[model samples]
Structure formats: structure tokens, C-alpha cells
Target: MPVLDLTDLPAACPPGTAWLGLDLGEKTIGVAASDTSRMIASPLTLIRKTKFTDDAQALFRLMDERKVSALIVGLPLNMDGSEGPRAQSCRAFARNLDRIRPVNVAFQDERLSTSAVERFLIEDLDLNRKRRAGVIDRTAAAWILQGALDRLRP
Candidate 1:
């Protein structure tokens, strides 16, 4: 397995194995997981930034523990759909992870994902700024994963 195109992910993964989603930020990596049936995605955890080896190890542990067979990483595309430094960083991270784990890794356009999650937290959940900051990335990862799952659904 390798870093895969989004169009190829559904076919690459085995049935009943969940998908993991990642939001790779400068300070932290937000994580989410899909259901075994791939119908829903939920916020999982936040990994504080350290060395890349440490981060990949933590991610690998989670994948093994949760039976994740594929990954859908959020690509921070610009509003105009251009790749930025953040997107390149994300791709690099995915490439490194692929080398270590050999799992199907795909990217989803994550423009406005954080803002959308913030809006939901404020308007629907009524979370304050501090609370939103604590969980926003992971929640955004869920939002990104859910979008991909929706597209993957038959």
C-alpha cells in the first residue's frame, strides 16, 4: 500500500476495517475515525507535535488498536483550490507515514473545515472560545472524514 488517490481509497480498503482521518497542524495532529461500516466518523484524539518518529508511532498504535485499514488526511487547500505550504506539509507527512505503515492514505480538501466546525460549536453546541479551541481540530477532522465517507457511500 501507498499514498493513494481519493478515488481509489474505497476499493483499496477491506470491508469492515475503519478509516482514520487526520488534520495535520503545526502544533498538533487532530484525529478521527470512521465506523467499521464506514457510515459515520467521530473525533478521536489530538496528538501533540513532537518528533516525526514519535508522531508516527502514536498514529500507528492507534491504527493497530482501532483496526484502521486506511487513512484520509485533511489537505489544507487554499480557498482558490491551490496547494499551499500547509498542503505540501500534509502530503509530506502522509508520504512518510506511507513509508512506515504501507497503508492506503488519501487527502481530502479541508478548506474551511476548521471554521465550519467552529460555527457548529458556537451556534449549535454553544461552546465557548476556549472550549472550542481545545477540540476544534479533532472535530474538524471528523467533519472532513464525514465528507469523504458521504462521497464513498453507495
Candidate 2:
């Protein structure tokens, strides 16, 4: 499937399949997966950047293993609500993934997602710097996925 608008995602999914969320950073791609009921999102893994093919292969492997039915990729929009290079890069990545897999892909505005997750890890969870760094990306992926899931709730 092609990339979809946020408004179109809920209707696009097949029943009983989960959604996967991605936070595509320069150095790593954070991943999160939803439950079969599409209610909860949990941090799954972080894939270190290599080649695009490698990244896509790893993601597809996860999708196959997890029975994911859709994808939600973070769009790092500027504070002014404009697309930047990073957002374009994410779009490009989504496009590439779509070419390889027949899965619904959508973008979620990810303003301050990382900061929010980091603050939660530091202030709420009392994680140290190293621990925070190790898990921040996957946690951010969960944050992005949760935001989408909240919107999907009726």
C-alpha cells in the first residue's frame, strides 16, 4: 500500500493485525508495535543505521514476525509546522518501504517526541544518561505510536 493520510489510517487497516511505528533518526531507527487489538503500543527494538536495503529488510523481518498490518512513521516537522530535510528523509524512507511491502504507511507529526520521551525517562523513570540514550529512540517510537492510537480511539 502507498503512504496514507492520518485520517485514512483507521479505515485502511485489516482486522486483527497490529500497527508498527517508526522513528527514523540519522543514526538509528526506533521501532514500536501495537497489540493485535491496536490498543497499546510498546517499544520493540532499535535498528542501527546501515544501508537502506538493510534497514528495510530488518523492518520487514520484524513486520513478518510481529504480524504488523500497517506503519506509522514519525514526521519531524519544524516548530513552525513546516517540513524540513529530516521530514523529507523520513518520507523518502517511507516511500522506499512502501515499494517493498504492501503495508499502509502514514506520518504522524512528531514535534518534541524525543524530548518528551527523554524527559519521561529522566524525570519519571529516573534513568541515567547512558540508559536514556540506549532506549530513547524505541521509547520515542512508542510515543509516536501512542499519539496515533489515541487519535484512532473512538
Candidate 3:
């Protein structure tokens, strides 16, 4: 399967199918999932980085358990909106994942996603640095997924 645009995602999957959101960092992969109705996105879990096979297996396991029908991955675009190494890595990861599972994949613009999540955790939630670090990845994944879900709203 190819990486799809947000507008195309609903067409790719059946209604009431769950969607998995991923924020792939160097050391961890943050996971989030939407309700079967595609209305709410919530932080799920974090996968500590390991070998590619292990990471993929872990992601696949989550998808299977969650009954995920599509994947929405955060793409870390440069400030100028140019594709940088991180963005390329995200695209590569999506392509590789597709090769393994052949599921619908989509990318959401993730500029400042992490920073926004950290700020929210600190200011609104009043979380300390250590606590923030532990949850920031999955929170950012939810933020990213929420953005895409909002776009899908009728």
C-alpha cells in the first residue's frame, strides 16, 4: 500500500475501523489510536526502539490487538516546510511498514507537535520534566492523530 493523503484515508478503510497513530522518535515509537468512529484519538503506549524487525513486530502486534485498519504517522517537516532527514526517515518507515503489513498509511504535518505536547503537559497538566518525558511521545502521537481526525470531521 502507498502512503495516502488525509483526505484519502477514509476511503481506504471501512467505516468503524480503528486507526493507529505513530510518532516515531529515535529511541521510541509513540502510539495512539482513534475510536472506531474516528472521533477521538487517545494515547496508547510507547515502544522502546530496538532492531527493525523487533520494532515492526511490536507495531504489528499493537495494530492487531487494536484492530487498526490504517496508520497515520507524524511527519516532522522542517520549519520552511522542506523535507528534511527526519521527514525522509518517516516516509521510509511508512514504506517499510507497508511492505510488511500492506495497510493504508497517511502522514500528518507534525511541525511543533512535540513542543506543543510538552508545553501542554507542563502548563495545563502541571507535569514535571521526568513525568513529561515519560509521556510526551504518546501524547504527541495523540496530538498528531487528533489533528488528522479533525480534518476528517464532517
Candidate 4:
């Protein structure tokens, strides 16, 4: 459907409907899902990038399986809050996906999200680089979605 702002998420995805969080990277797309009550977010899967069409299909399949109706994509904004090429690519990805799918989409500023996840994986969890790489993206996706869901709470 339409791309929404963070503030527009609750209204678009009412209660009892799940939403998917997407951390879109150049080579991989990390995915997470919220509980039906919209309270908890959990890392789901990582989709290795192939072609745009294939990527979109994979995303849709996930949404279909989970009955998710909304998407919260992490936008890689520069530290200065400027939209760089990465952010622009995210926007384009959202728009292009919206054109073909019927899910509501929104972006959450993802500054340092991956870094934060990486730090947690290392310091707190004691995971090495290889192990961190395995879960970093999906964990970052959860981080992004949790931030948005926190704002949605009263």
C-alpha cells in the first residue's frame, strides 16, 4: 500500500496484526517479526540478496507465513542525520516494494544499530566475529523494530 512514517504504524497495523522489521543491506536482508500484540520483536531470518524481484518475493513469502501486514525497514542515515546513498537506496527499495505488494511500510533511523548489536554480541555474549556475523543482521533488525515498538507503547 503506502509508505508510512513511524508515527503512522499503529494506525496502519492495528492490534493483533504482526509486522516485519527489515534491515536491508547490499548483500543480505535481515528480518524480524513482532508478536501479534505488537509488544515483542524477535529475529526471524536472513535473506541473501540475489535479484530485486527475488528479494521481494522472499520478503513477501515471509510476510505471508507470519500474517504480517506492515514493514518497518531500517534506514541507514548518516550520523549527522543526512540521507546518504544508503538511505536513498532504502527509500527506493520501500517504494519499489510497495508498488508490487500490499503491505504498509515505514523506516526507522538505524544509526549505529548494527554497531550496537555487534557490541552486544561481543562484550555481553562473547561471540567471535564469525558468530557475530551470523546473527548480527537479524539482531539489528530486532533492535530497529524494538525501537519503533517502544515508541508505540503508551
Candidate 5:
């Protein structure tokens, strides 16, 4: 499998298969997954970053258990819509992930994803700062995945 555009992701997956969403941060990897119907995304878990091999193994274990068939990774683009070092890092991670599992991976623009999620946690959920910090990464991953799912709408 290869890194694909968001629009091309569906073709890479078999019907009824789920898609895993990843928000790769410096210290932790946020994980989310779409329903089998691909209708909704939910925050799953966060993987504390370690070695690449360990991280990959952790991610793969989750994917396998969830029956995920593809990936939608958050691409941290600059506000100017330009790819920066973070975007490059995401691409490299995607490439490495593909090499390990041969899974189709797509990048979704993730500008303001974390901020949006933080706002939701504060305003809507009314979570305390400490609580928010605990789950922000996974929530942001869900937001990123939701954006991709919205684009897939007919």
C-alpha cells in the first residue's frame, strides 16, 4: 500500500472495514477510529512515545484489535497552508507505517485541530485544565478524523 490522498482512501479499504486515525505528537501518539460504517469517529487511546519500533508495535496491536483497514493521519500543516517540518515528519511516519503493515495511509490537514478540541473541552465539556491535559491528544485525534469523515460525505 502507498500513501494516498484523502479522497482515495476509501478505495484502498475493503467494505465494512474500519479506519484508524492518528495524531502524531512529539511526546504521544493520539489514536482514533471510525466506525465500521465510516460514519463516526471516536477517541480511542493515546500511546506514549518511545522508540519507533515500540510505537509501531503498540499502534499495530490496536489496529489489529479494532479491525482497522486503513489510516488517516493528521498532517500538521502551517496556517499558511504550507508543509513544514511537522508535515514532513507526518509523511515520514506514514511511510514507515506503510512499510511495516502495507496499509493505505492518507493525510488530513490538521490546522487548529488541537485548539478546536481544547475549546470544545473547555466550553462544551467544561473540563478542568488538568482533565483536559489528560485527554486532549485523543480528543484532537477524533477531531482530525471527523474532518476527514466529513469530506467523505456525499
Candidate 6:
């Protein structure tokens, strides 16, 4: 399936399945998942970047295990809400991900998502640098997913 507009995800969502969230970084892909009710999101895992085929297969396996049918991928937009190179890369990932198998994907504006996650970690969790580095990506993925879920809620 081609990537759908972000707003189209809820309507296109299939029953009895959950949504997966992705925060794509240069070296890793952060992952999160929504509840079947689509109300809450939790950080799931991280996928270290490797071959595209390897990454896709790992992601697909997680989706299969978790009954996930759609992806809400973070779109790193400029502060002015413009698509930049990073955003374009995410769009490409979505397109390429679809080629392996059918997957509905949508972009959620991810301005400051990583920084916001960092702030929360520092202020609330107070985790040390190494610990923060270990969990930041997946935690950011949860933040991204929660933002989408909040907006998508009726």
C-alpha cells in the first residue's frame, strides 16, 4: 500500500489490530505500539540500522507479532512546517517499506520530538547520559506515537 495522508490513517485502519509508530534515525529506528483500543502507546524496541532489507524484515516481524497493520512514522518537519531532507528520507522509507508487503503509513509532524524526549528524560527521569542514550530513541518513538494517538482520538 502507498503511504496515506496522516489524517487518513484512522479511517483506513483495520479492526482488531494496532498501530505502530516509528522514529527513524540515522543509525536506529525507534519503535512504539498502540493498544488495540488505540488509546495508549508504549515504547517497544529499537532496530539498529543495517541493510534496508534486514531492517524491513525486522520491522515486519514485529508488526506480525503485535497485530500491527499500519505505521505512524515521524515526519521531521522544519519549524515552519516545511518538508526538508530528513522528512523526504522518511517519506522514502515509507514508500520502500510498502514494496515488501502491504502497509499503510502516515506521517506525523515530529518537530522537536527528540529534544522533547530528552527534556522529559532529564527533568523527570533524571537518567544519566549513557542510560538516556540507551533508551532515548525508543522513548521518542513513544512520545511520537502518543502525540498521534492524542490527536486521532475522537
Query: Highest lDDT, which number?
Result: 3
Give all candidate RMSDs, comma-separated.
Answer: 0.9, 0.8, 0.7, 0.8, 0.7, 0.9
Model 1 lDDT at residue 13: 85
TM-score on alpha carbons, each prediction: 0.97, 0.97, 0.98, 0.97, 0.98, 0.97
Residue-wise lDDT of candidate 5 within 1-154, one digit each (tens)? 8888899888888999998888999999999999999999999999999999899999999988988998889999998999999999999998887787787889999999999999999999999999998899998999999999999989
Pairs that collide in candidate 1 are: none
Flag clash pairs in model 6. Answer: none
Q: The CA-based lDDT of model 5 is what? A: 0.92
Report the lDDT tens digits of candidate 4 across residue range 1-154: 7788889778877678899899999899999999999899999999999999999999999998988979999999999999999999999999999888777998999999999999999999999998999999999999999998998889
Per-residue CA lDDT of model 2 for 61-124, tens digit only, reads 9999988888999999999999999999999898887787677899999999999999999999
- The Cα RMSD of model 4 versus the native structure comes to 0.8
Candidate 1, residue 44: lDDT: 96
Q: Weakest 10 consecutive residues, lDDT, candidate 3? A: 94-103
lDDT for each residue of candidate 1 in 106-153, tens digit (9 for 90 to 100): 989999999899999999999999999899999999999999999877
Clashes (backbone N, CA, C under 3 Å), per candidate, total: 0, 0, 0, 0, 0, 0
List per-prediction Cα lDDT, in the order shown.
Answer: 0.92, 0.92, 0.94, 0.92, 0.92, 0.91
lDDT of 3 by residue, 35-123 (tens): 99999999999999999878999999998898889999999999999999999999999888878779899999999999999989989
Which 10-residue window in model 6 sums to the lowest lDDT?
Answer: 1-10
- Tens digits of lDDT, candidate 6, 3-42: 8876788788887689999999999999999999888989
